[model samples]
Target: MQARYYTLNEARAALPVVKALMSQVQEARSEILRLRPEIWPVLQKAAHNGGNAAAGSVYSQFDKLETGVKGILKMGILVKDIDMGLIDFLSIRNGREVYLCWKHGEEDLSFWHDVNAGFGGRQPIDPEDF
Candidate 1:
């Protein structure tokens, strides 16, 4: 499938839904981490292609995480770090593709980075740039 790129307005328009989805992703991830000790054995078994009915809760959290991440990807947003709730919307800047960077808890999307820059290279968006 061709990659979906968002205009600045379009990306902003999608922010509310993105925030909700990220909340789900983060909540599921936190629960998964919290259950790590209890589910470690089940996880190890599953790595060996075995299933354990005893780890149903862990499995349910995995389902929720997968659903949330997939939901975001289906909208063409790149989820960079689920733990940190980092995401990027592909957008054009100066006629080149760049990422509009956003993280969980941010009320607005106000940063951008070159395609190769990653999160470390994020820069505040200039109002005139977008």
Candidate 2:
């Protein structure tokens, strides 16, 4: 798929929708992690003995989590870290690809970094950069 490039303003404008989807992704991710431990044991028991009643619920959670994440990815937003709620929008800066970075709970997209530079290299977005 072709990469979608967002201008700073475009990225900002998309934030509300992105934020809502990210929240759903985070919740689904958390549910998967919480159910992970129980799921394995349930699977193991079912393999040796009989069907596990809880297994169905665990699989359902996994399906929902996968669907939620896929929905976000389909929007061209890279979900860097679901637990941390870090997402990046592909953008052009100085004629090169860069990431417009936002973390969970941030009021706006105020930082960006070179494509090669991860979150550790985030720099405050300069007004002129827009």
* Top candidate when judged by TM-score against the true structure: 1
- Candidate 2's residue-wise lDDT over 30-76, tens digit each? 77777778778778767646646566766677677677667667878
Q: Candidate 1, which segments miss by more than 4 Å at Cα?
A: 43-54
Best by lDDT: 1
What lDDT, from 0 to 1, does candidate 1 have?
0.88
* Model 1, span 1-130: residue lDDT tens: 2348998889899999999999999998998888888779877867647556546777888898998888889899999999899999999998899999999999999999999999999999986777
Report the error of model 2 at residue 57, Å. Answer: 2.7
Cα error of candidate 2 at position 41, Å: 0.5
